[model samples]
Target: MDRSRTALIWRYAGRGLLLTPLLFLLVFFFYPLGSILQFSLAPDGKLDFAAFQQIFSRPYYRETLWFTTWQAALSTLLTLGLAFPAAHVFAKYQFPGKSLLLALATIPFVLPTVVVATAFIALLGEDSALNGLLMKVFKLEEPPLHLERSLKIILLAHIFYNYAVALRIISSFWSNQSQRIQEAAQMLGASRWMVFYRITLPLLLPAVTAAAALVFMFCFTSFGVVRILGGLKYATLEVEIHYQSLSLFDLPTAGALSVIQLMTTLVMMIVYTNLQRQMTQPLNLQSSRQVARKPRRWAEKGWLALNLIVMSLLIFAPILALIERSFTLGDGGFTTRYYEQLQENPHRSIRAVAPVAAIQNSLEYAFFVTIFSVLLGTLAAYLLSQKTRFSRWLDPVFMLPLAASAVTLGFGFIITLDEPPLNLRSSYWIVPIAHTLVAMPLVVRSVLPSLRAIKPSIGEAAAVLGASRWQRWRRIELPLITRSIAVGATFAFTVSMGEFGASSFVARPNQPTIPIVIFRFLGQPGLANYGQALAMSVILMAVCAAGFVLIERLNRAVIGEF
Candidate 1:
């Protein structure tokens, strides 16, 4: 065929692939969001702001908003402080087990909120084994600890979940900086602290700001963490949304709160995105092989040691406690009954599925979500890298679902699909579709950078040599972008696996996910239930860890080969 016809065919094929994501987003995201707007505006076919008025008039709603803001701010500050030093260490040094340590640091961030809450409770609750051990060590007559059901506990969990965000974003920038600037600063009689404050810290400010904004937004909209650990006293906007929607059935109030929350999040994202754009600069280095020749003084060693210790305690201890509880017996012996009990059907409980079935459900949903999200995300990323106006506009629109809370989105889905024209409420597809909405942004973000890194000339060269479009993409683009696709798929898998908010709203009674099952077990007050929760948590962690490792291996095989 002539070049004109070949180009035409290629363009149409590309459009077809790209249209899939747009269609998916339109049906699941924009349609549901439109439904939410309609619900909030019209009650009985009349336009009203009663929902907004009710939310504003109530002191409880105001309190929830205020508490949520403060808690999220505090958590962001704490996470940044802890993550800065760790990021610096990782960026500057080539330590043993560096990859493994980085992986471990991220584990807590990806685990289900319910699992993290339960793990924390297992380690530090009033009746926990740690409290018992402390009591014995101190020779006290009673266990004296009250960590659970406190605002502090909630804040700590937020920090644990988000520190990786600060670390990764800041450190990625940090690794690209030229060490010679710091060396020159040192040679000019600048102290270590002075160099960091005046040079390193200033350089990292953009990424730091972006990371903080994201973390703050996450904590502000937190539901599962606050619900499980914050008790009734510490309700965020998210928890309030949940209460208004589910417990009180006050859709108007919930809808109003969700709109406000969505507005606030969008504002934050806009401001952060603008700031990030302003601060973007060319990297001094692109490779991670760059080394800092500065010797590790005693203080630096101590700092590393302290960070390692803190990470172990803060991230791994709770997970270890969960595993221990899963195996510990009431009579102080090891047992496997918790795992065994998972084989039993959960229908015996209150409107719950079998634990094994929940696992199956979660895995199946995760698998589909991963596949769909990666495909859409990859296409969007590829289009965006072409730097077309159409892709730029579409890019931010695609990310809107991420800014909205899952609770808000779930409510939107519920209100939108309650009727006949396009009913999706009772379908199994609802949860996976919601999950795809949630996971797509992550996939796009992961793949976009890698796509941009591939020079446009490579594809042009193939076309000039009379190579077919399919052969060019298959032999060139696909090989280059496969690792990114894998990374995006891994992220989607983990996000869907641990997802709860949307799942809770859409999950069928007979098809509960693992997180839902764990939440159920935690609600009941029995050894068997608690053990089962811990055991399920362990399995959830294992699933996430195994997925992560597989992705890492893929990265090594494909991306690392370059």
Candidate 2:
């Protein structure tokens, strides 16, 4: 009878804990999303398909759809091609400065999209040193390579920016894999290539598929890279949404486009999740005692060296260009003018505000996003860990924001809340709200794994020793999951600071964020503007680096290792 009573009490307590996250999702996520869908379906205050029909009827829109689809597909393929070998190398080999190289590879992923776009321009722009050098070497009167405003440039930028996603996912999975299977195949008279194809590739399929799906989705919704490099010719759903809403003031059409984009993203995510379930297997490499061996043949070492050198150049060249350009002067001498410009107010700029204001705005939004997302995500994770029916359904729902494009969601927010008791536009709250939507999913993913790692009996034990529910949570669960929460918060902070798509739509004109400011400067002409842009980019990089270091230190203190 006592055991039954205890079980019943615990069940109710778990249910109560679940309610908070449920309420949060219902209010912030589901309701806003539902409002947009409803508004898109009935833009004229009656049931109609006018918006969608208009979009499908137009040839331009159809062309955009095709362009976005193929470019994203090509980008994913290229990224996979580059990332797979790099991931394999990192997983199988140990070398000097491996950690630094890995961190450098990840830098592109966290950088602001505008910074990346500008870096590409600085590297290959009309008056760039690369263009000048090519002209000089070839004795040509004109710039020989005109990659600007081309589909190929857009695709390359996407691959460069998102390849890290594939590398990280594949490398993590590969590191936790045992070499015994491959060794056994080799001993059975299998060639090295055959062994990899027959054994290693099959086991790595899950991570590969997951990474591809994610990369595809990211490329599909790409806006800044497409807009900056592809020019007006290449319009993805993201770019179309922005142009339709802001430039053309076609809210209904934008809403319709957003819905279509959301559906496409959702389908991809569902396919990936289902595939992941089927691909699951016991990963015992973590406990396996055998150490990895280095390649013995000279040819193998030469091949490995060539691969590493090529990957390093591909990943590092653009970054090196940016850093070098940041210091270069017109007279071919090094200068600190760009770095100094960051400290001065440049009010004559289009935005008419000090650069520091943008930095502060980004930092503030990131802080709020980190705090709220971590708190709410931790609660949701705890509820999910308890294994309730409602919790199971809720788990996927929290991930909807991640599956939806930021541009689409921002458009949804614009149309749905143009007026009403929940009107949010034309307010300071828009940017942070949009950021929260994006960061929440990262928070949940990070927290859920840690929450699941803790055994339930620990909480029960504390409760049995006359501890109150709050005391049990404070002393046990919180301590166990604190590192995960910090990691989630760090991710949220970095994402919020660097995010551009939603910020462009929602940020107030006077209160533009760092990325918005960088874009503004890059669009203008002149050495001063270019210098300022580079300075701002450096500042943004410093902020991200500092935040990551703090996260690393906190993780070590709380969880002992990442």
Candidate 3:
């Protein structure tokens, strides 16, 4: 009778714990989205489709939509093409510093888009060192490089941002898959090309498609790159939303664009999730050491070296340029003026604070966000990992937060959470809440694999030995997945540290984050402002890179789905 009562209590407790994540989403995610819909479709309690009509009827919005789509498609193709060969090399070749290379490749994916823009500016802008050197060398009066504020730079930045995402996903999947099928086909009188086309291509298709969809999703909703690199001429839907809402104060148009962006990203995410599910199909797997080999021939070695050089140039060159430019003025002597100027409010601006304060504000928000995301994400992970009917449908719903753009989510928060009980527009807590919505999905992704890997029989055995549900989780699961939790926590912290889009809308004027400060510095006139922006970006980059390295270390012991 006691055992039966205890079982009933534990079951109810489990169900209650599951409801926490659902409640969180309902209050935060769905409520904000609903507020945007309500505000856009029916202002003053009347139905209207004027915003939607304007988006379709106007040439400007129409062109923006087309540009957004085509650019994303182009970026997707270019990223996949660039990363595929690298993925193949990483998967099949056991090279020195392979793990370090993989970790370095992934750092860009975590970096703020603002930092990426600054990196490119340092490398290719008209007044950049490269163009300056070229002008001096040829005794020319004008700078040479014209890539900045062009379509070419936009594409290049997109590829740089997403290369690691594609490489990691495809290579990780490729490494685990068995190569025996291709070997068998080759031994049965088929040529290498024939075997690759018939057997290898089909096996890799799902992972490739999955990577493409995710890359397209990112490029489609790109904000910082377009806003910074493309300048005033090019505008994606995300940038348009920001313009309409903040610059123009046109909420209807902004809300309409938000809905469109949300719906489009939803489709892409759904496709990605489905493909990812297909990618997990059981296969004849092989260990990486068993399949990977050292490059023995000169041709193979040359190809490997060539790919490595390209990867290094593409990923590391701009960053190195940014760091060098930060310390040196256009006149060529190294100086610490920029770093020193970070503490000065030269203009004594009323609306903005010093860059040093922004750093402190960012660290505080990151601390709170790490706690919120780990708690909420762990609950969501446990709920979704359970082998229950609810888990299947809820899985996609939880990912909806990830699909929604940060700008849209911030806009939603402004409109929805302005009431008496939930008023947060002026509160500092609101920033962390907005950041948590973005970071939680990552935490969930990082922690879910650890939970799913646990066998049910082990839990059953624990229960049979008179262990309560809480006791079993605390004693067995907690210790087992500690490293994964740490990895998730690190991701949440880093993501909050560099978040820009949502912070732009939600952060208080005097309490800015690091990215917000960088944006402010860039907007101001003078070389000092630009130098300060670069200095702050380098600082933020170092923090995020350090976090990424820690995550890699933690994740090595327990690999996560991320």
Runs of candidate 2 with Cα error greater than 4 angstroms are: 1-18, 132-142, 175-188, 283-291, 343-347, 552-562
Q: Which segments of model 3 are wrong by more than 4 Å?
A: 1-14, 348-350, 460-469
Tens digits of per-residue lDDT, candidate 2, 1-562, equal 9978997898798778667767766766677677667767887688889888877898988888888898889999999999998888778766667667777677788777777777777677775668878888999999877888887677778877998889988887787788788778888899999988888898888899988998998899898888777777778999998998899998778878888888889988997788666545676565212333465788767866877887777777767667777888355579998777766775566667877788888888888888877777777777777677877887788888888887877776776656777777888877887888888777778778777777878878888888877788788878877778888888889889988898888888999999888888877888888778877877787677676777656655453222
**Pairs that collide, model 1:** 346-354
CA displacement after TM-score superposition, residue 142 of candidate 1 (Å): 3.5
How do the candidates rank by lDDT, highest first? 3, 1, 2
Name the candidate, 1 or 3, with the larger lDDT value.
3
> 1-562 in candidate 1: lDDT tens per residue?
6978878987998888877888888887788777666667776578999887777788977777788889899999999999988887888777678778887787777778888888887877765788878888999887788888887788788888888878887877777777878889999999999998998888888888988998988888888989888877788888887788778987777777888898989987897777667556574654556653333788877877788787778777878887887788365589999899998865456464568888899999999999889888888777677777888888788788888999888888887876777688998888988899999888888788777877989989999998887898899988887887888888899989999888878888888999989888888887888888889989998888787777667767443211
Q: Which candidate is the best by lDDT?
A: 3
Tens digits of per-residue lDDT for model 3 on 1-562?
9989988987999789877978988998899899899877986679999999999999999999999999999999999999999998999899999999999999999999999998898889876888888998999999978998899999999999999999998998898889889888888999989987888889999999999999999999999999889989999999999899889989888998999999999999989989999988898888988889999999899989999999999999888988999998646899988889888776643255788888899999999999999999999999999888989889878878899999999888888888978898889999999999999988888889999998889999999998977899899999988999999999999999999989998999989998888877777777888988899999999999999999988988995887
lDDT of 2 at 109: 80
- The per-model lDDT (C-alpha) reads 0.82, 0.79, 0.90
Q: For residue 182, what is the lDDT in candidate 3?
A: 86
Instruction: Choose the strongest candidate by TM-score.
Output: 3
Q: List all candidate RMSDs to the true structure.
A: 3.0, 3.5, 2.1
lDDT of 2: 0.79
Ordered from best to worst TM-score, the candidate numbers read: 3, 1, 2
